[model samples]
Target chain A: MLSFVGLGISGFESIPIEGLETISTADIVYLEQFTSPISESDLKKIQDSIKGEFKLAKRWLVEDGNEILEMSKEKNVVLLAYGDPYIATTHIELRARAIENKIKTHSIHASSSLTSMIGECGLHFYKIGRIATIMSEMKSLTTPYYVIYKNLIEGNHTVLLLEYNQDKKFFLDPKDALKGLLETEQGQTRNVITESNYVIIASRIGFKDQAIVCGKISSLKETDFGKPPHTIIIPGRLHFTESDALKLFGKCIDEPFDNSEKTEKISNQMMKKYVPMVREALEEIEPLYKNQKEFEIILDNAERYIKDAEIFLGEGRDENAILSIGYADGLVDALRLAKGLEFKM
Target chain B: MLSFVGLGISGFESIPIEGLETISTADIVYLEQFTSPISESDLKKIQDSIKGEFKLAKRWLVEDGNEILEMSKEKNVVLLAYGDPYIATTHIELRARAIENKIKTHSIHASSSLTSMIGECGLHFYKIGRIATIMSEMKSLTTPYYVIYKNLIEGNHTVLLLEYNQDKKFFLDPKDALKGLLETEQGQTRNVITESNYVIIASRIGFKDQAIVCGKISSLKETDFGKPPHTIIIPGRLHFTESDALKLFGKCIDEPFDNSEKTEKISNQMMKKYVPMVREALEEIEPLYKNQKEFEIILDNAERYIKDAEIFLGEGRDENAILSIGYADGLVDALRLAKGLEFKM
Candidate 1:
């Protein structure tokens, strides 16, 4: 039998009764070290609770082929993954390998940073898009940037997790992450992210001293959010309620520019130019489309228009491009009409 | 000051250490009953942990305007919610309300069903779509069909949470739910679901002795899954890895259907009749269209032809219809390329 157990987000106390039982009953216990690390104190607590010797598995043990599969045979083995068992692609592969060997597999789940802890910062879980992990030396990689760009195009909020070394003594802070993202955006000529935009900086989530600070990217450079295991969030479109939550719980008062004024100006400009185009697009397409066909067309056209508009904005033709896309959306009845389509953007 | 603390999934043990501290220190604690009900034993355990008194808040206190909000002004209030604090839309509103009144607000999040817990039954979380709650009296409502239909079309899994009523000792069981869903699908003229299809029935998830069974809906109808808090899952598209997992962990084992045999038969029957009329339509539109445009026209015509070809399959067409739809997903790439569009299915 192969069991995958989540040790909860913060510490040992967060694990549910079922998860504890699974860990205790296993013949051999292994912990995946990459996703989220359990502190020595927490590890000791789990050992005491389970009354078993816990072994740490490197990323290669789980990610490499056949090792875990071989271990699953002839033993009641358990793999302890931080957060939920299958949140990462690595664990998924592990489970797949175990199943192929006809091993009795179980996933004892607990709180994950993806959902439970992210909500503590007052962000809606449903509104979040694909999560991005920032590497310590991100210049060598395009994977993280690709995830962020795709998530932005989908108009879903992106959660940026900072990469930490094995010791947990060092981590990529939010300011450094913003700089890296800004540099990447500039390199790619993606204008979606800017210094004036508000980003949420959260530190020590699932802990008593957890801190959440919301401010412009420029202002965040000088502020210390405190501690490791921090994350940054780049928001896409904000709802009225989300905006209100930001104003209240986030450090919106310390913004570099008048956010309300900028928001109003942006809204006014969008309404003036884009709304009419969107209306025209809807009128032109509505007569010819129905059911799934209509939904597919609208989704396809909307994605194209949004992409074009982003390019136009990046090239400094903001007004014409914004209006043109707005008109296109209007023609498609884009004012939340595409909600049923579940298109990311 | 106002605090929203998530009580984690599966009773008292699932809560993080920070959440417990917040509840222990709060002058007034208000737990929302509607989202998730804590067992009496769990409540007693919590009371024993905390030095202060805990108050149970009815649904009215949460939904009613300004009641909880007003109380937060006079007291250091902590509002307890199930799973994560921001999973529900109401909690978002409450946080915003607290912020508006200048009351300092914080959240201590814990476990939520949104995690990879569903994988306990060997199902992937990413494969699941927008979750839909199944009410006890779904016979009178059209929602179940709509939600299931959407999930099926998108090739995503659906998690059907059985409704819990406070006044009555009634909870919807997986057996009744399967029957209800089968009836609803039949009534709507959708034939994707059948007695032979595999369904996962999970009960008392996150608790000790949590039961998970996977089998044909007909096979499961006779077995008692045991206890309250049961959920039913209908899987859409299965990856090779997922298929293996299901085969290993899932109770039902049957010979896998041959896709090639079904597809070839369906294609041959449809091609004999529908291809000629589609070709005729393509010929008429060829003169006015560009090369790329003409390709799109032909593809659209082909899709329309396939839809019409469904009439040939008749009642025996149910299984074939599902298989065909799954195969047409390959043509979806061609359709997108020809139409020069980008969209999620």
Candidate 2:
């Protein structure tokens, strides 16, 4: 039988009581630290508590998984990892492979930093959107940047996990990741991340030295996060309670504010620009078509649709709103084309 | 001082080692089952372990919070809740208030079903989007329905939490929630949910009798989920490994499949309909403007844009695609409106 156990996020004491017994009784325990490294003192305490043969399982050992599966066929084996074991897709895939090979498998879930950090930062877990990982080698941060945009438009918070490569003993700095996101804003021009945007950096969470620091990108550039395994959170709309808690939960260099106010949805941005332009074009061509009876209805319909677009936007029907405005724009521009006037679309 | 502790998901045995020690030594422990009820046997085990005064806190007690905060002014008080502590916003607010009142607050994080359920059902945790809850009193399920649509477009799984009213002893049945979504699909007409859509119902997760059942909604219509604290999962795209794990980890009435294939983004759906309609309209009107040199540029631009819309949709620029198509359709319909003929948009 194979058991996948999580050490939780707070080092040794965070493991579930039942998980402790399961690990001690297993014939072999493979501790995988590639996901997140542990401290030496915590490592000593973990080793001292185990009664079975303890082997340090590297990333490749867990990914390769053959030796572990073979051993589990005859002996009880536990593959222990930091945070919730299955949060790492490697562990989930291995569990599937074990079941495919007719080996009985068990899982002991624990606290994941993904969920833990949000509460620790005093943000509602339900308000968190799909998470993103910031790798050091990524050609662009557009994917993560757009994630923040979508989440912000819906008033959801975004959690971005920094790259932690155990083999290279490397942890991507939160500052550099923020820098990358700001650069992405330049090309993508979504205004998702700006110098004055509020961000929280959660470092060494669930540890004695756990710290949460919040500030704008420019201000946080000079600040040093104490250790590795850091996460950056870009908050959207903040309830007053959340704002109050954030001020107390972390060291905020600036007052807590929403990053979403300045970041408009692409649809909203286009409407803002096109609504006026279309209305102006319609106004210009309406006088020319006053005597033309057939075009009167088209102009009237265009004006009505533009009004409907604004109402739809006010109701948060963004797609329908865009469609209305686009139709109105098309209607007016076509009239301009037929009349031999300079066209605007 | 006040401490917020999590009972994890598996009753008393699943509590973190440190959490157990903290509760055992505290002056008073408030066990709140309003969020999720505890089994009688599990309740007995928990009461037996606590060395402190144990009080069963109603939802109002936790929400009111005045008595707890007053007692914690001098005593070591613990607020024990199901899963993680801060998942309930009331607890987070209470903790924040405790700090505001000059009382020190500590939190012992534990395994949350939010993270555990995904791994338990063999789904990737990172692929999960913002969670939504369904209540019987809600006028409609449109909020969660649209949330599912947005998540599906991004190919992210959605975790739908069912309403559990401890005061009323009511848990929204997974079947009913599915039915509500289907009813919503009729009026919304988004094609986001249908009887054939794949879903997973997770009941009593982290308990010995934990069950994960997945299939098409119609296939699982008669399924007995057996207990409360159930959660429904709507999976988007599934990797082959994820599908393999789903088969092994749970009972499937039908083979595991992707639910996202049928739910196209609204923009893509629009382009699919408008691209051809506009092209056909353009072709019919070509002869009308064949001798008109001034209007040729408008017709040509409209056709080129219609083609650009298709290419843009293929490139995954959904919003841009919708805008371009809308512009082309507008251009075509405007010409059609000027001519004495049937109009198409």
Candidate 3:
């Protein structure tokens, strides 16, 4: 039988009571720390608590699960990891393989920093959208940038996980990640990330020296957040209670504010620009076709569609709104072209 | 000083090692069961483990918080709750208030069912979008319906938390919530939910009797999911690995497939219909103005916009695609109307 146990986020002391017993009684235990590094002191304490043969598992050993599966066939084995074990896709795949091989498998879920940091920052967990990871080797940060944009438009907070390479003992600095996002903003121009945008840098969470430093991106450009294993959170709309909690929960260099305000949805952006433009174009052509009978119907249709576009937009039917405005603009511009005037579309 | 400790997803046996110590050494410990009900046997075990004064806290006591804060001012007080302590917004608010009252606060983060259940179901945690709660008293399920729609369009999973009332011992049945979504689909025709859509019902997770039953809505209609504290998961796009793990992890009445395939983005839906309609309209109007020099540019521009719309749609610029197609349709309709034909828009 194979048991997958989580060490939770706080090193040795945060493992669940059941997980402790599982590890102690197992014939062989493999502790994998590639996802997140463990402290040396915690490592010592964990070794002292286990009565079984403890072996440190590398990333490759867990990824290539032959040895673990073979050992679990005859003896009780526990594979422990940082955070919740199955958060890593590799672990889930291994579990599936174990089941396929007819080896009974058990899981002991523990604390994950993904969910903990949000509460530690006093942010509501339900408001968090899809999370994104920023790898240092990525050619561009556009994927994570657009993720933040989508989450912001929906008034949902975004949790950005920076790269952690345990083999290299490397961690992406929060400052560098922020800089990459700003650079992405220059190319994307969706107003997702800006200098004045509020962000929180939650470092070493679930540890005694955990620090949460937040402020405008500009203010944090020079600030150094100590230690590794940091996460960046770009919050969306904030309730008053959330704002109060945030102010008290972390070191905020600036007042807490909504990042979603500036990042408008694409539908809204198109409606804002096209609605008035189409209306003005319709008015311009309406006067030109005052006496023309055939053109009169086109102008009337254009006017009605302009009104319908606004109503559709108000009803949250954004695609319908854009379509209506575009059709109105087309109607007015066709009249302008037939009249030998400059087109407005 | 006051401490907020998480009991994790399991019963008393799942409490973190640090959490156990925190509760045993505190002068007073208040175990709040309003968030989730604890088994009587587990409650008895918890009482036996805590050497301090143990008190059962109701929802009102935790929300009011005044009495707890007063006690913490002079004594070592601990507030224990199921799952992660800070997952409940009320706990966060209380922690903030504690800080405001000049009291020191500490948090022992543990396993949150929110993150754990995703892994248990073999779904990627990063793909989870903003979660929503469905209550029996809600006038309409439209809010959560739209949330599922939005998450589906983004290819993200939606975690629907069923309402749990500790005082009334009431839990919203997963079938009722599914039925409400189906009813919502009748009024709002977004193809977000249908009888064919796949869903997973996770019940009593982290307990010995935990069950993960999943299939198409029709397949699950007559199925009985045994207990309360159930959560419904609507998966979006499915990676092959996720499908494999899900099938291995749960009881599937039907084959696992992508729920997102049927739920197309509104922009894509619009383009799918409008692009061809506009092209046919343009083709019909082309011969009418073949020789007219003044109308030549209108026909040419319409053809160009139609092609541009398709290009933009392929590039994932959905708003631009909708705008360009709408413009093309308007151009075609105007020409058709001027030529004594009925408008197609």
Looking at model 1 chain B, report the run of 10 residues with the lowest lDDT sum: B257-266
Computed on C-alpha atoms, the DockQ of candidate 2 is: 0.74
lDDT of 3 by residue, B257-342 (tens): 99999999989988888888889988888988889988889999999999999999999999888888888888889999989998
Better of 1 and 2 by DockQ: 2
DockQ of predicted model 1: 0.17
Q: Ten residues in a row with the worst lDDT in model 1 chain A?
A: A336-345
CAPRI rating of model 3: high
* Model 2: residue A15 alpha-carbon error in angstroms: 1.1
**Of the native A-B interface contacts, what share survives in model 1?**
0.26
TM-scores, all models, native as reference: 0.61, 0.98, 0.99
What is the per-candidate TM-score for chain B? 0.72, 0.98, 0.99
DockQ of each: 0.17, 0.74, 0.88
Question: By descending DockQ, how would the candidates be arranged?
Answer: 3, 2, 1
> Highest TM-score among the candidates is held by which one?
3
What is the DockQ of the complex in model 3? 0.88
**CAPRI band for model 2:** medium
- Candidate whose DockQ is highest: 3
Q: Write the per-residue lDDT of candidate 1 for residues A123-239, one digit (tens) a residue.
A: 566556546678876554355665554445444566778887755557777788777767776765545456776778877766566677887787778888777778887766666
- Model 2 chain B: which ten-residue window has the lowest total lDDT? B336-345
lDDT of 1: 0.62
